[model samples]
Target: MVYIAAVVAVVITALVVGDDTRGAAGDPFGADQAIRYIVFLTVGYMLARGLAKAGSWARRDDHG
Candidate 1:
């Protein structure tokens, strides 16, 4: 969770500190791309956390 949050902060900071000379069409890391990256990161993190919890829960049930 901390790693994901750090990555998101870095992405946002990069977007803000990036050069502004390039046109929107020419920029590869535009606002849309950043948003997509953040969304994907969040979803992936959530899915991973859910799977981890499920695995632990199953293990606990089996042991108990």
Candidate 2:
């Protein structure tokens, strides 16, 4: 769900910014940027999940 939301957000952002807004090399929201976006979003999701899991683990009372 998070990944889907991230993709939607990126697409909307690129569309809103317009094609004329592309960077010097080429399309800012082109294939390469899309791949990079996916990779970053996936990594971010994993890190967030890992941190949340760690937090819950730390808060639990194992000796109880």
Candidate 3:
């Protein structure tokens, strides 16, 4: 589910960047910046998940 959400977010972001309905001023940071931000966010999420899983694995208690 998280992966699906990420994919959808990326696609929507791409569409918004490609859109050219803005005024003559144009985008503030532009498409390249937007893409970089999205990639960074995705990596952050993956790293968080990995850390959480590792923590859980290390704290396992076999005794009930």
Off by over 4 Å in 2: 11-25, 58-64
lDDT for residue 55 in candidate 2, whole number 0-100:
77
Clashing pairs in 2: none
Determine which window of 10 residues in candidate 1 has minimal summed lDDT.
55-64
Give each model a TM-score. Answer: 0.59, 0.57, 0.52
Ranking by lDDT: 2, 1, 3
RMSD values, in order shown: 3.7, 4.5, 3.7
Q: What tens-digit string does per-residue lDDT give for candidate 3 at 1-60?
A: 776687567767766764576567775556676678678878988999989887784445
- Could you say which candidate leads in TM-score? 1
Give the distance in Å from residue 10's predicted Cα in candidate 1 to where it truly belongs: 5.1
Sort by TM-score, top down from the best: 1, 2, 3
Error of 3 at 14 (Å): 3.9
In angstroms, the error of model 2 at 3 is 3.7
Show where candidate 1 strays beyond 4 Å. 9-25, 58-64
| Tens digit per residue, CA lDDT, model 1, 1-64 | 6856867785876577546777665655667777776777778888988898877745535765
